[model samples]
Target: MEMAPMTKRDKILLYVVLMLSFIVLYIRFLLIPGIENVQQAKADLTEAQDAQTAMQETILMASVNAADKNTTWGDLQNANAVYYSLLSSDELDTLVTGLELNHNMDPVSLSIGEAGTQNLTGYAAGDNAGQTAAPAGSTAAATDADTDAVTADTVGTTAAGNAILQQILAADLIPQYDQASYFRTSDVTFSCSGDDSDFFALLDDLADNYPSVQLQNFSISTRSYAAADGASVTGNVYNVTLRVVLCDKGGVQP
Candidate 1:
């Protein structure tokens, strides 16, 4: 068979048809699968990220629930009041009132005085006065003796109170006593002048109130007073000071 000669227009038309067929096959086989894979990957990534976020949210919610279950407002307030009493005056008053009530003591005339500061001025003045009042060698000796006696008395009294306090602590009244680690006792001094009987009565009341606490190193002083009618009440007024050492049975962090 004789072959027909191809024209430039026919060649061009043939090339166009071949290119169109290649483009159609590429779209159907290669482009479609590639696009589908990319779309599937994006969907999978989105789903994975959403699941991770949900898990984190669940963990956070569980933590919040646990915290709520562990603590209560009343417990928090009581804990706060314990240590806070050391810093606040009003809170300290409330604590004292609570203590008095617990001990069945009359809160009346029970004053919470300011914390004591070191009496450097009194010591200095006493030393100077003693030096000027007495001869050189003997003055120093007398002053030293007096200071030693006072120190010994104070130490002895403190030791007695501390022994009692330790027993009370061992009895375990305050569950969180360890939080109140800084315990102290001052020398007992009279608050005012009053009858000897009234002073003893006050001590008795205290003794009755706090049976758990042993009253040791106890002392009293008295003064005279007149009634409103201008007649003397005759040993009517009395002042008392008590030194108390506190102990704690250990429990709780705060």
Candidate 2:
């Protein structure tokens, strides 16, 4: 027996089957991958655009802040940096010696007291508003009987309160006060002898050079002495007390 001849309907059906398989392969291998690639490219482009926008905004803000005349943002930042600049004991002494030498003055004594913290609350004028809580390392100087009696009469209450204040500061118990508000102060007593004019000039220079160091007390007196040869010498002597203050508002590290 012989097989029957192929029909047109059978041929058309075979072509249709082949076309369907080709379409499925094209979509699975090529079309789907191309669509995914395009989607990823779009996402990356969006991220880059967002980053560029943020950069531009930052630059614009900086320019605006830099244009201010009275108080520029850069100046404020510099002030903050200076506010936190602390002076060590050796540096403080060097600074004082430099000033004395510049003013042609003879230094009699220079003492750098221990650094202490200020009281958060204020006191009345006679109640020792200016007194601070001495740090733990500070030692009270010994006084003679007569001087001790006078000191107790004048500052006994102040000293007692300062003791309590020191404990509070050591324990971090100050209410409504944080570390940011903490400021350290080191007292300096500098005694020197020079011409009155030179001493005044030195004070002016000190103010200009070190704004952080402030003059708290100033005393001047006349000194008369007899030399070995019996000749008398007279001059002016200056006793100055200064306070150097520092803060951590700029987030400076130790």
TM-score, one value per model: 0.28, 0.43
Residue 11 displacement (Å), model 2? 71
Candidate 1 lDDT for residue 141: 25
- For model 2, the run of ten residues with the poorest summed lDDT: 143-152
Error of 2 at 14 (Å): 68
lDDT of 1 by residue, 203-250 (tens): 565443332222334344333455546665444333444433222212
- The numbered model that scores best in TM-score is 2
Candidate 2 per-residue lDDT, tens place, 82-188, comes to 23246678977987878888898878789999877764322323233444433443223111112111110122112222333344444433343353246677889
Q: Model 1, poorest ten-residue lDDT window? A: 147-156
* Per-residue lDDT of 1 in model 2: 94
Task: Report lDDT (Cα) of residue 202, candidate 2.
Answer: 89
Query: What's every prediction's RMSD, in angstroms?
Result: 16.6, 14.2
Q: Assess candidate 1 and give its TM-score to the true structure.
A: 0.28
